[model samples]
Target: MAGQIPIIPFGPHATCTLELCPIEYSIFRYRPSLAANITFVVLNVIFALTHLVLGLRLKNWWFSGAMVAGCVSNIIGYAARVFLWQNPFSFIGFLLQIIFVGSAPVYYTAAIYVTMTRTVENLDVSLSRIKPKLYYVIFIVCDTGALVLQAIGGAVSTVSSGANAAGVNLALSGLIFQVATMLAFVGLLIDYLIRYFRDRPVASVATRLKLFLASLSLAILLILARCAYRVAELSEGYNGVLFHDELLFIGLEGVLIALAVVALGIGHPGLVFKDGQANLTKAYSPVSVPGGAESGVELVGK
Candidate 1:
């Protein structure tokens, strides 16, 4: 059995002399953390349910759908961890967690990008360097690209028995791309906020708008931190020392994402937009006139 190559369905009797599967050998070497996995599963379930209820009540279909997708991925990812806890050799479980959890945040960030567009529309679109629609177009497209790279890389790694160096590189590239997109978004967000406040008196800004901006900013920061940590983790190959640090994974990946989801709930778009209440027809209007007529042009030059 010592000389035989390790094969799937690994067990005590298998001829595969390999000490552990590369997918999550660090986790398998020691029993997977049951408590940590279960906690994440529960947290994701709550986040999913809350978002669904709020989304339906507020009629925010797009936001709700993205959050639901992320939650489902989290559920599957942690459930995979639970399976690994039972049997570290479960290849299917390892693949499930790796792909789903790794890409789940992409959906969340996309939702956030959409919200940014809405924010710009709601608050002085003239203040932003980029138009509201372009924010959605640019960031969502970038998010899609990141999601594809990650999904492809994860699939390739799974097919290669989790030993492919190319797969890791592809995934790392996706993470790095995501980080760059987020940084650019932050720059735009800061610029818009600064210009809006400087041009318009602070007293004109609504308290609710302030809250929404604060909440969105917090979520973005949390996500950026999580993605940065992931980039570092993957920088080291699968066998890198980072894999052995369960606490780091739990804190950076699990806890940070969980907080971001919850922050979104607190700062939900529904709170500000008020379900068909905002006059989107006047979103880019320069001024309001009698009979609810808006100035036809956005003459305020950027």
Candidate 2:
């Protein structure tokens, strides 16, 4: 390709003309085998199809939407890499996947927020201190903040070849915001889980609830790992040591996130929400009150 780096794909790459660009240079860093890349592509595509069907079949819009967002980003990003494998100089393909896939985690995070809050509402909102609406407002705002920051970072780096300090700063800031949001979410989740499990009604799907909580935790862990990788990668600027490491990005961001998505799917609220077993009114009795009504408000205090 004219005006582009002459980079090789992964292993035993054929020699080319121009020098590799910093961004394209790492297209195969710590790189997986061609076989692994193929696996990643296939797995993500299958996940996307499954979510598309489930979202439509059950009308679980939020979970379905988030899964779709994640799968789409992963697929598009990998597709771009596939094109670059043909010719690593294709900057356009590089950007399309990098930006979309990098930010896709945010949507999954949002989906988790929706599901968890919905669980609270559908199960026992009165036991919780924070209302479901406020939880939505707060977490979604954080998600939007992360999205905008990452998007700006992508735009800025594109114009400046990923070395723009401003762009790196913005991206890092967004990631930091996401990390903080997740930490808070985890705290609330732990608190809620403790209270819920301790006082759970006989009707609650205990096993399913455990799975949902586990999946949500896995998602948070994946996002946290990705953010840490970004922070390390960007701290050194575009050409810095970790900046162009494709292998690291794939392992830390790609595989970690893909695992989280699958985990979340297994623990989806649909597992718990199905069959109306969670209906609260008929399951609880005022007479079973812990404090003989002297505690004033009915609380599932742990």
Candidate 3:
């Protein structure tokens, strides 16, 4: 026992430094990539700045705020990863990444939810089953719930140093809830589009609207995919195979979300909505009744 190296416990309370403990003892079981994380940080900063400028210029407050917040969360999360690259056993770094990175996409989803209302209102509000405003209200509320779950789970995991099953389960529930919410949102969007095009042929669809819809759809799908991946990764808890797969994390979590952020920028409502307010008069003008009375009703009233 005199010549043997002393084994150190790995956790927040662990006195193990990188010099003392093996990297395998770290929560991730591997060192986080410095270059990859730094790249994510840079990408998020650029997109965040872009959204900030555009949001300010067009006064798209909600969209801008959500995007900026999401990007900032990403920045902080990846920065934490950078710290982990230096010290894989760092409790603070692990906690930051778990909490911030895990919940960042909720903000992106929140932005999309708000944008959907405007998109439906601009295209044809009557085609949607629910009021355009309800899209944000319902989905944003769900997103908030998911965020709260994930945040609490992350906190518990940190406190337990990644050994708590309940904490992992709570986070997994959040991801699953988020994925389900996104699926429902996509279903409603597709339903609206189907009804819109069926009633008023696709040839009449504006090019701008088409691009916005395409970008929006792409963003939704990407984020949904990422959320699904996260759910799978968290399913096995901290020591799961997918959880330790750096390549999977990079592709699924990092690349997928980065592309989604880009898609959101391309499909920003300010550029498509033309001043960001629905032309209610145009969308729902007065209709002439048989008795010669002008009734204020939507053209395609539900």
TM for every model, in the order presented, reads: 0.83, 0.78, 0.89
Candidate 3: pairs in clash: none
Worst 10 residues of 1 by lDDT: 293-302
Ranking by lDDT: 3, 1, 2
Task: Assess candidate 2 and give its TM-score to the true structure.
Answer: 0.78
Comparison by lDDT, 1 against 3, better one? 3
> lDDT per residue, candidate 1, 21-56, as tens digits?
453343234556899999999999999999999899
Using TM-score as the yardstick, the better of models 2 and 3 is: 3
RMSD of 1: 6.1
Q: What digit string (tens of lDDT, one per residue) describes model 3 on residues 1-302?
A: 88875555455676667888888888888999999999999999999999999998877888989999999999999999999999888888888888788878988998899888987776667778999899999999998898888889878876787689898888888888988999999999889878766644444455556677899999999999999999899898888899899999999999999999999998888776545677422334343334666434222112
Assess the local accuracy of residue 166 in candidate 3 as a C-alpha lDDT between 0 and 100: 94
Badly placed stretches (over 4 Å) of model 3 are 1-9, 280-302
Runs in model 2 deviating more than 4 A are: 1-33, 200-205, 275-302
> After superposition, which runs of candidate 1 have C-alpha atoms over 4 Å from their true positions?
1-28, 200-204, 276-302
lDDT string, candidate 2, 80-172, tens digits = 767666556455655776687777787788888888777787656876769876677899898788878978886786556565789878877
Q: Model 3 RMSD to the real structure?
A: 5.1
